[model samples]
Target: MNPLIRPRRLRTTPAMRRLVAETRIHPAQLILPLFVREGLTAPAPIEAMPGVVQHSLDSLKAATADAAAAGIGGVMLFGIPSTRDAIGSAATDADGILNRATRAVAAEVGDALVVQTDLCLDEFTDHGHCGVLDARGLVDNDATLERYRDMAVAQAEAGSALLGLSGMMDGQVAAVRDALDAAGRTDTAILAYAAKYASAFYGPFREAVDSQLTGDRRTYQQDPANRIEGLREAGLDEAEGADVLMVKPAMSYLDVLADVAATAQVPVWAYQVSGEYAMIEAAARNGWIDRDRAIRESVTGILRAGAGAVLTYWALELAAEGRV
Candidate 1:
C-alpha cells in the first residue's frame, strides 16, 4: 500500500488545478440582467450597484449588441417605467417601456442571444408589490393572475423568448403559460423564480427598478427559514409547465438551489442578486479581495451546487476577459 497521499500534487500548479476542476464557468452559461428606464436621453448609473446602469433605449441596443458579440447566453430585461397606478395599467400597454425595450432588444440581437422579460407587476405597480393589493392592502392572487395573463400576451407580442415568472402569485406559471398559448404564442417559454426569497439581498434591485414598495413581501416570497418549501415551489412550477426554474440570491440560498436542482427535471438556474453583486464589487473596490478570482470562486460554488446556468451582473465583463 502507498504511504503518502499528497492531494497537494494536483494542486501544485494552475494548469494542474485547471486540469482537475470539477465545475467550470462559460460565457454562454451567463445571463446579464439589464435595466431600461423610460424617457432617458442618456443612461443613468445606479449608486447602489457600481458599474451597472439604467440604459436608455439607444444605450440598451448598444448593450444588447455588446452582449451578443461576447457570446453570452442572454439578457434579462427589467423596465423602469415613467408612471404607475394602483392597478399598473401601463403594464399591459403595447407601447409601454418594457414591451418597447423587449422589441428593441429582439431587433438588435436577432436571436444572437435569448431575449427575456421580467413578467411581473412590481416594476409597474404604484405600490410595488408583485400583485394588485385589495382594499385591505393585501395582495390579491387571482386578480394578479388576470393581470399576468394580459402582460404575458404583451411581452410575447413584443418578442420575448422567455417570460420570467417572478411575481410568486398562486398559479402564476400555469396562468402565464395558458395565456401565451391562447394568444397563439405557443413558442414563448417561462422561467419560474421558484424559490425567490424575502431577503434583504434585493435592496439594490429595488433601487435599480425604481420600486415603490413600502413594506415587506414576506406574504408571497418564500421564507428564508424554510428549505422544503423551495422544493414545493419548484414542483409546482415544473408541473405548471415551466421551461426553466431559478433560485434567487443564490450565494445565500445554495442549499435551496441545490434541492431544486436535484429534484427539477428541466434546466435549473440561479441568480446572484443585486446585493450579492454590490457586496463583491464594494469589497473589490476597496482592494479587500481579488476581484477576478472572487467572481470566479463565487460562481463556481453555485455551479458546483447544481446550477446549470447563472444570472450575474458580470456576464459581459467576464466574457470579455476570456475567463471562460
Candidate 2:
C-alpha cells in the first residue's frame, strides 16, 4: 500500500470527506425546469413523468415563487401550447404559452432568481420537430435559424434573462444573438445546447411537453458517439457569443460535459433531462433504491463532473428538502 496516496484516509470520516471534497453542489447551482400547459385551469400530471405536472398560469406563478424562496438558482420554463402549427407560430408569438410563462416566472421571481425559457419549438410544432420542415418534410436548418431569431426577441420581451437554445440547429446561437442585439436586448444571455445528443433519455421530456415528434432528432442533434464533435460544437457556440454551453442528458454524458466544461471559456451546464429523472423515480417507487440518497448522489455526480449548473426537475424539491 502507498502510505502517501491513502485516499481512504480522507474518506474515513464524513467531515474529512467534506473538507477534502473537490466539488460542491448547492441549491443555487440547480435550476428547475417547469412545464406550463396552456388552457389548463388546474395542474395536469404528466403520466410518464411521475410526480411532475404541467402547471396552469396560476400554478406556475406559485411554483416559481416557491423555487425562489427555496434558494434555487432559477426556473427553465417549457410551454405546452393549446395549438400547434407547421411553422410553430406560437413559439414566436408574444402571447404564446412559453413567453407568457416566462413573464409569469419573471414577475414572481424578478431579480431574485435568473429566469430562463426554452427557446425550442418541439412543444409547439404540429410535426414535433425542433424546427420547421421543408417541402420534403426534412428539417431546414437555415429556416429554423430565422424562426429562432423571432423566438429570441419574443422571449426577451417576456422578461427571460436567459434563453436556452435547445434546438441543436446550425447557426442558431449566432442568429439569435444577432437578433437580440438588433432588438436592443444586449443584456439577454444565450445558453447554447452545444453538445445536445439525440438520446432515448428524452422520452419522458416528449411526454412532459406533449410532443408530436414523428421521427428521431438525429438530423439536428449531435450523435452520441462523437466526443470531438461535441467540443467542436461548444467552440462554435463560444465563438458565436453564447454565455453558457450545455451538454444534454447529463448522467449518460458526464464525460462530454466535463470535456465541454474544460474546453469552453463560458460556463458549462448539464441537463439532467426528463428520462434521467424518471428512471430515478421509477426505481425508487419499485423499492430498488433509496429515493433521497439517489437524488443527492445523482446531482452530486453532475456537479462533480464539472458542470457549472444543472437543469433538473428535482431542483425545487432538493432545495425544499435541503438535500443540496
Candidate 3:
C-alpha cells in the first residue's frame, strides 16, 4: 500500500467530486454583453461571430428582459451610432444610441438587473481611437479623460446603474468619478477596465459594434508583454475609487486576473471577449468540441481563477438551461 492517503478517493463518485469542487459559477455572477445598432429596423448578423447579432432597439429590449429573467447580474450595453465624428459627440448626446439603450434597459429591467453601459468613444468616433488624437496623430490621454467625464454624466442621466469604463486612458477613473460626483450622480458606480490589454481577441467585437476603426488602440491600451504592469494598472484604478476592476480577454489573461483579484480591494471581473466566444462556437460547430460543455468549462475556469463575475455572450443561453 502507498504510504500517503490515496487522492483518488476524492474522485470515487459524483457526489464526492461536487463536495470537493473548489469553484462555483452562478447565474447571478454572469453579465450579458449586448449591442444595439441605432436606426436599424432589424437585427444584423455579425459574420465574424456566429450566432451573435447586432440587435435593433426593440430586440435589445427583449434581450434585456430575458437577461433579467435569467437572474443575470447585469447587462453591458454598447451602441452603434448612426453617425461618427472626431470627438465622438454622440457619446454625450442625450439622444445618443447608447444613452437611449441605457434608458430602455433600465426601464425594462429596473432594479431586477443592474444596467451598465460601455463608456468608450471608439464606437462613436470616426477614427476608431478610444480618445481624441493630438496634432501628432497620437491619442491624447487628457483629452480622452475630458470626454469620459461627459460620457459618465450622460450615462448616469440616462439611468445606468454602472458605467463600464472600457477606454484605457490615464486617470480616466478619477476623472469620471469626479465628474459623476460633481454632477450629483454619486449613485452611479464605475467598473474600470483596469488591466485591459491590446489583444487580437477584439476582432469579433469590432464587427459586433460595426466599428470603423482605421487604426489600432495600442497607443492607449496596455501592451500584452507585461504582467506586472497589469497589477500596477489595477492598483491605480482601485486608488481612483473604481467600484470594480476588470481584465479583458479572460482566458488569455487568467494570470493577470488572479494577480489583480489577489490585491484589489474592490470586486474583480473578467470579460470573456468576442474572440474567445467565437473560437468555441467555431470549434463546436465543426464538431471538434461540445458547445454546452465548452461554455461551462470556459466560464468555470475563469471563476476558478478568482473572477467574482464574468461578462459572457453565453449568459442568457446558459441561464435559460439552468446551467450557469
Best by TM-score: 1
Q: Taking the tens digit of each residue's C-alpha lDDT, what string does model 2 give over 173-279?
A: 99999999999999999999999999999998888888898879999898899888998999999999999999998998999888888778889999999899999
Q: In model 2, how large is the Cα lDDT of residue 118? A: 92
lDDT of 1 at 129: 94
TM-score of each: 0.98, 0.96, 0.97
lDDT of 3 at 163: 94
The 10-residue segment of model 3 with minimum total lDDT is: 315-324
Q: What does candidate 3's lDDT look like per residue over 36-80, in tens digits?
A: 999999989899888888899999999898888889899999999
Superposition TM-score, candidate 3 onto the true structure: 0.97
Model 2 clashing residue pairs (backbone): none
As a whole number from 0 to 100, the lDDT of residue 260 in candidate 2 is 85
Clash count per candidate: 0, 0, 0
C-alpha lDDT values of all predictions: 0.94, 0.91, 0.92
lDDT tens per residue, model 1, 36-150: 9999999999999999999999999999999999999999999989999998888899999999999989999957999999999999999999999999999999999999999
Question: Per-residue lDDT for 286 in model 1?
Answer: 99
Off by over 4 Å in 1: none
